[model samples]
Target: MVIKPKSLLKNKALNKWNLFWLISGPISIFMIINLLAVDTSTGAGISEMIQFSVRWAVPFVYLVIATSSVQILFPGPFSRWLMRNRKYIGLCFAVAMAWQALFIFIMSYFFHEYYYSDVYYFRDEIEGSIGYIFLPAMVLTSFNFGSKLLTPKQWKLLHTSGIYFLWAYPFSVYWWNLYYYENPVLIDYVFYWVGFVAFALRIVAWGKQRYELSKRIDPNYKTPIESKMLGGLFIIFGLLVSASGLYWQDLITSLFTCFSMVRRT
Candidate 1:
């Protein structure tokens, strides 16, 4: 098949998004479980169940739809169809973020102390840390204040550092939970391993992109076939990660549900 440039770029974007979910989705699930199942309930147990279910289920469903829409609207085989629906995709992401913020507030205050205690722990650790400070920095830069107040280099630095911190938060939470509970579960190990793998791949990708730029800086430079080879390797890796993440998500959810059931009974 003749691969058009646009098609290739589109595929690359989808692959990136796929890898992103692989890294991010599991953390989302873990948070959802902690927010709903392990968290204390008030009113009727059924009411707690309903609230928890909505908070957990709806966000993921919206995430799937939004990310898929991003894949479709931005590029890939379905770009044309996706372009027509791009507004909906953006709206979905906005809605998802809103839902996420709501949970953050609920999980921070309304529930048992353990949930917010974790948040405060992170806040304390993250406030003074070097590379870790970027997560908040990036969120700041993404808004108008950073754009207007910070220099270009400062903004770039904030975003670059922020990306790594955002990725690290999930695994950090898992490890903290494990240490606190004194039980190292499979999911803990999975989070650490998969999160590191994802982070490593990201660093590698950044390096490769830099190498490509350096090569291009030379007047005689021609793009190497090795670039395509690297891309192909990443594509394969992306698929595997996506599949593994989905499988683990189901497994984790089931385990958490079982534990929650046992707790009540």
Candidate 2:
């Protein structure tokens, strides 16, 4: 039996449960390794584990946020796979966060003084608590049994808002890493651009869709030349914000702060 590569991709590559564990299993294993490897003797050790788990989680969330937009902008097999497994990808994120939550509990309970003094910030705590609340709700609704409990609109509302809330956590962290911190690491810049492109793709896709819909609704409808020129300018301006982070640092920092993730360690 000869298997064609293309046929294999369509027929069996990344089928649901396989894809889920394929991503989630490794993430879980790494968290376990961190548990064993890191010195659990101090709250500082637990904090490193929390940071490790967070790095694993953020990329999956970003992929979920960008999935649909990727399909819209560039229709292809890779994008289609992402669309199909968006739920599983999100579940992978949940698995990673679960590890972070476990470490958080260990810190808060066992190393109360260290947790309170070094790590605790009231605004960050509030945001993180809200994120945890949404996390389980999203995981529950990802399955049909829990989803059956909500109307279609209700389900949509929960997931949409939850995704944005999750995205904001890391986006703000990296935002500050680049602009607000004295000495930012290389990984910080990598994450900041990856996230910037993810959200930017969605915005560009939205504008494309709005134009297409307007044209379809009324054949006579024509976007003015001024609007077209303004669209180009908007793209350039957004790029400028990315390139010249220092100029807009203060305002962007203040705005993104205290919302979902006001402050990040």
Candidate 3:
């Protein structure tokens, strides 16, 4: 039997609406499981469950933010598919985040004693609130009707800054944990660096596009080879950082599994 080519295997005809539900259905199911499985009897359990929900939501948020950057870096079938379905992906992220917010509200209602007293709440009031402020605006403008109300420049400004704001919340959280926590999780460190790389790539892409536009306006202006060199340097640095992060992640996972087994035995 002949193996199918990757190009042939790629689903170029995916409907965005169907794609949205396909991605969101599993997430909704996962949230349901978290809601059922979390021990809601204690404040600690509620805190753990809230973290679980937020952790699960983070990847989708990162994907929605990184979708355009990824497409810019690698133009291919997968990237094209991502570009086409990005709005749906953002919607999925919004749904997940909204559920996470609901869990937070429930925690505040039931475990007000701890929730109000915790330093986490105070920190969240600053960092998390700012991030949440962008969510509703971004989500509302994501639809055609809402987008139509804004000029093209206004829409672009809203989303460009909104994505960065959303990106910063998780990045800052993970970066802080990596620095201040005695024992930071490998995944958190990985995510922090991954967000950094994504942001860097986005800047590089934007700069390149802007430079091209400038060149078009001023034909006499020489293309800046130095800027290209800097971008190449950044890509190299990013790849090295990503490689090390993944390596450490695997090493830590293996050690943790071994330690768990030893404890069980």
Winning candidate number (TM-score): 2
lDDT of 2 by residue, 186-248 (tens): 889888899889999899889879988998999788889999899889889988978788788
Give one digit per residue, the lDDT tens place, for model 3 in 122-214.
667787887788888888998888999899999999998988888888887886677545688888877887777767767767776787788
Model 1 off-target regions past 4 Å?
A: 1-146, 176-190, 213-265
Best by lDDT: 2
Alpha carbon lDDT of each predicted model = 0.50, 0.88, 0.77
Cα-based TM-score, every candidate: 0.39, 0.88, 0.77
Provide the global lDDT of candidate 3 against the true structure: 0.77
Error of model 1, residue 170, in angstroms: 1.7
Clash number for model 1?
Answer: 0
Return the lDDT, model 1, position 131. Answer: 33
- Order of quality (lDDT): 2, 3, 1
Alpha-carbon RMSD to native, per candidate: 13.1, 4.4, 9.9
Error of 3 at 262 (Å): 52
Error of 2 at 78 (Å): 1.8
